[model samples]
Target chain A: MTGTEPTADETPTTRSIPAVAVVDAQTPGNVGTIARAMKNFGFEELLLVDPPELDPDGEAYGFAGHAREDVLPNAQEISFDELVSSYHTIGCTAVTNEGDHNHVRFPFSTPRDLAQRLPTVDADTAIVFGREGVGLTNDELARIDEICSIPASADYPVLNLGQAATITLYELREMTLSPAGTQLPDLERVRASQPLLERLYDQWDELLVEINHPEEKREKTARMIRRVFGRADPTTREVNTFLGVLRRATERPDQEE
Target chain B: MTGTEPTADETPTTRSIPAVAVVDAQTPGNVGTIARAMKNFGFEELLLVDPPELDPDGEAYGFAGHAREDVLPNAQEISFDELVSSYHTIGCTAVTNEGDHNHVRFPFSTPRDLAQRLPTVDADTAIVFGREGVGLTNDELARIDEICSIPASADYPVLNLGQAATITLYELREMTLSPAGTQLPDLERVRASQPLLERLYDQWDELLVEINHPEEKREKTARMIRRVFGRADPTTREVNTFLGVLRRATERPDQEE
Candidate 1:
């Protein structure tokens, strides 16, 4: 399931490519703040790659304020490679269109521009934000289909991750003419559902080992599975597909070693 | 020494006309916040007209943040009549472009556009924000030379006075290109100066009493006076020349009175 491409039945019109992503994020405070911003803008799918510092109770609560449940606990955490491999139309926040992928910079895209583009893609879209201090490496930006930048002072070109997220989500939400599109619950409901990720993680770890990959490849393989679920944000059918994929991988019979 | 038109000898370049005016703005928090915003965008002048609610200490500190002293005491309190009679170009913050005043930045200027226009006007460019809840009255707007709007969501566009001020100033500051320009005040030294505007206010009030006729007309007279000074952030020479006019008025016996 992780390696498979979309089949014939995949709906191209449901463009769920999100308007935000956090890459190698280091702070839970920023994550929570970004979540609040996402909630405000009505975008729930949050993607994080290689987040090293995560404290749900301490930082996320403080930053999220009134809207925590809007944050997906199943926020897929994967490596840089898997993230690029999964998405068809990912925009990086680091470089602009003028910049080359090796010197990658996300070109400045107004929220209105992204809002218009979001609904057209066949696959999930990703808006990627980089780590707190250093931005996305040029190599990482290479995989992004669009590179957009927020025009800021050259004196201090970078925005605080939360502020950047807030502005993007706010703009997109502003463009949302349909008020009833997605009804978001409060923080408590989201927290109640976080345990689902923990359970899924346990199941995934078991399948990773049974695939009988070399020790060096086990973590890498497990991470790719995380990536697929992370970017796809699978609905019931997709989630079921993942479960079947895991079941088949583990149930395969081989000579006992 | 608070009001005067430009003299023939003065060659002009560069002006900072603020976009929001809080005439006789009642809330101290709002006032301080406006001051803080002015300081944020390098705007030092503020005009007040008939404010019944002002607690200098509590508000100046909170809104101005690190630059409390930047709130000039004279700007802290000025008669509306004085502002009106003094300014050559008093631009109101009107949401509409239908009025007589030509070329008001409508549909809002990008922060960059406003910044580019800053250097073209003379010293007397004023951005007038209205009171806390209800904005400036239509009659008040009708009298101004022009109107300026800071674009925001039409759904509920009223920005908290401070937040609105902050965004305006932030946009201007961001638009500033620092190279070849003199260095701005180091972060530590941007405190609001109170004494200069305070001294100017003393002279202005006395002038109002001098030029001010009929007790019934005194308050209305004051509002107009404030509007003038609000637009013309008079220089020291300009203030002194205007003061001389007022002093002479007081020294002479009025023929009618």
Candidate 2:
């Protein structure tokens, strides 16, 4: 029964990411968890349909992480009919039909597919989730414009509500949030340059000769070393360390003799 | 302290999916949630390091869904050193370093990348997750051979332990499970043949003739109908329905006049 009126300035038309709608959620904690996931993935809007009482001191608040202040408090409440008419609705269903015989669930897009497709769509979209025990009713799913399913094991395709929402948001993060919003370190590493690699390989060859390595096997061994380093994609620091180790080994033969 | 000896016949060598290891999980419910996600994605083995007491009547059992009888109960207890020594470990972390200076957290693979890379690796691998609140310590991350990170919004990059495990498992399902294991319907729907589409287009032209549709507009309207049906990829049933409706519309104009 808890609802709030969206401010005139912050309407659905102004937002780019899809609003998340939970219909008849039995547990307040799940609502909070979904809201938290929304914040985690840069989704701003939340809509609830027949949600449980979300008291300030309840489990919902406890599980909301950082979303309690914004995403949870500003959640708008709307009727199912109003949701269908106002936005392009995509129903989230864990259990999908196996064939086109039941078109309500078949021909569904996975979250990855939706991530790619939703960008070209011009309408403001809402991704709807159903109750915890039984997902969206067939009638409700039929009314939605499209269906989205997460690919899972046939034996147990059903994921708990929170997990489903979090995973879906994670897949859609690229479109919903800018690349600058990721905390993951930049993937571009400064691998050792070709000259440095060649010097290292020469040192390795010299060490093999110093150790009385067979002349016939020297070429093969050198090729193997190149392949190994190529696959490892060693950084400059790693290559320098290897060079140092090889220098010590190559010099040791003279010292020992 | 609870541990079981893995039977001789069913060892790590025979299994294809990575063993999911939870290092010092504080909550029994989180442990159960991880186990349930493992089952959902066809991962079999569960390894625990200093886990909480998983009593039969505890929250662990309640939240395990179908994993209680198998994955949770059979979880093996091992020390962190034992984990590093026995398996090729890939540590899972939420917060990663921003540059190559911190090698422990940098140069990590996303779950999608791991899904492609792990299959080629010949060794048995274990994907390790750390504590809920503090995640894996830097020392622990350094010990693991590789790292896998789930991309998230920088504002709130951290995900609850259960959500991280669930999403990782979902991404790795392709390598872990068989194609026949999916419940999603076969995507190869029998689209209406070319002849059927031509007939439907011809019927639309006849309807335009019956209505005395403006000659200039008629060609454009016919092309639009063809384009719409082409994009729709309508099945034979749907195309027949369209033909039937168009035929009725064309016949009605003659009857009315």
Query: Top model by TM-score, which number?
Result: 2
lDDT of 2 at A161: 87
Candidate 1 C-alpha error for residue A200, in Å: 69
Per-residue lDDT value at A158 in model 1: 46
Q: Which whole-number lDDT from 0 to 100 does residue B128 have in model 2?
A: 95
- Per-residue C-alpha lDDT of model 1 across residues A77-185, encoded as one tens digit per residue: 7666666777654553533433212223423354446656665444656677887666676676767766555444433344556555655565465344244332211
Q: List the residue pairs that clash in candidate 2.
A: none
Highest DockQ model number: 2
RMSD of 1: 33.8
- Per lDDT, the best of the predicted structures is 2
How accurate locally, in lDDT, is each candidate?
A: 0.54, 0.85
Evaluated at residue B72, the lDDT of candidate 2 is 91
Error of 2 at A153 (Å): 0.9
Q: lDDT per residue, candidate 2, A8-112, as tens digits? A: 665544336788999999999889889989988889899999889999999888778889899999999889999999989999998776655656776678898
